[model samples]
Target: MPAVTVDNILTLPRIETPALTAVDRPVRTVTTAPTGYEGEGFPVHRAFAGIDMGALDPFIHMDQMGEINYAPGEPKGTPWHPHRGFETVTYMIDGIMEHQDSNGGGGTIGGGDTQWMTAGGGILHIETPPEHLVMSGGLFHGVQLWVNLPRSDKMAAPRYQDITGNKVALLSSQDGGALVRVIAGEVAAHQGPGSTYTPIALSHTTIAPGASLTLPWNPEYNALVYVLAGQGTVGVERRPIRSGQTVVFGKGDTLTVAAADTQDSRSQSLEVFVMGGKPLREPVAMAGPFVMNTRAEVIEAFEDFQAGRLGSIPAAHESL
Candidate 1:
């Protein structure tokens, strides 16, 4: 989905094949994401549904926001909301979204762009399709990932980072059979642009039919691979997986995925979102919008939000 691409993958840096000593991660579980609607009635796939919180430590939630083609006047986005104790990473593969926050962070991001907002302590923000996009709707596809902050940094000051597509590190599989777009963290000693409060690696990979990609992964981090489009097999055992499915990998130093020899006409290749992070290994208490370490803290967050302690909508965006 056009997050980023090169005319010739062979021109990009390649991820070296794992050494013979590298341990191959085995597939732990493969779960299918259920379809749902998100803000303003936009379609979404609850990418993290049914996955254990412990297995997703450092990652709280994830949503695959539409591969739908919206008709004119049909684009939708989230209303103003408050968040704390985590960061929200919005990566747009297509279409446009405008974001504004109470902390004086605002911007417009389009295809291949990413908005990284750390709602530490607390902040109010809203995401909406740009006016023009709403008036003349088109394809809209993206992913929003909720990354948990360590207890110590849960109350850190808020920050924002606008990472454009060109800023992402682009690499190719050892045989140039796949394109890997690194959005954050290091891949084969090559680092992406986004800074993270938690140690993590996030990448969107496209594998051509019949191709296999083996990625060197951090032994200490837990790995997950979510299929965005087409079909593929995961792990060393080569378990079959398709769109809307997610694979949680067991401990290992390398992760592998291979595309099927054929795919549906709608998707010519297998597209996957791969992410991993060092486990927080701490208690988690979450409410509707706030993630915290205790239920009492979650209640306190709601109280603060209602009391205007989080933040108020900016004057210019009051009409939104």
Candidate 2:
């Protein structure tokens, strides 16, 4: 049985149109900290990696992983782990990733593909590089985001969705200078392939030099943009941003991204991941791999994992 409750999943508000008259929202805050390595030695840059879970409610963690190139036989990846009360979204920009879970779910996602896994009640899963890739190492680049589930659906059954690049909704600027890939919400009247427990707009946008694109967004949602590559300006304020930087937006129904106008700029294109979601506005209790509304529930989750009630992945199903 699914762990998600009907009320929690069904009541999520959908934004079919802008709630406020379109206005160019300005950049509110910018975050850029040093990158670090985690998850079995993988290099990562995190967004809101701190402990204050409520600050990014409904969006717990975001890790931009491994833009590093590995020599032959030097690849590294994560081992098996358990999780609950949230969803894990892995979006690959380059290279490949293999995944195996307790529920007999296993697959490989390559460049431009995505895996959205819901660890509602609980599940043990492993995400790693492919065996061949480990043998003959290459480049690896991807991002993993943890989206929190509502209190009422914390114990819902787990699920998974593997979305290939072609399956994602794609939109482009009128002059073909910008492209947007809708991963978990609607863009240009097209919805993403993955089903979401909460209302969220997640997109991978790319823009060429001297180009600009405006996106309509939900006024009530908290919005943020993380620059993946190149330099660009965001919002009406034209807040300048570069790779490895994150820009938080203020209240408004529209935002703009403009690539550096100079043709001789170091970067030819600007790539970013745009994300926004409604805040849960509820207390959060989180431990390693577990998230809940209260400390008691978090304790119970750990107990369940220790008791093997969360299920375990078969060793044979996991790849290096």
The candidate scoring highest on lDDT is 1
The lDDT, on a scale of 0 to 1, for candidate 2 is 0.80
Question: What is the per-residue lDDT of model 2 for residues 16-49, given as tens digits with 9 covering 90 to 100?
Answer: 3344557778877778846888768889998664
Residue range 252-277, candidate 1, lDDT tens digits: 99999999999989899999999999
Best by TM-score: 1
List lDDT for all candidates, in order. Answer: 0.94, 0.80
TM per candidate comes to: 0.99, 0.89
Runs with alpha carbons beyond 4 Å of true place in candidate 1: none
Clashes found in each candidate (C-alpha, N, C closer than 3 A): 0, 4
What pairs collide in candidate 1? none
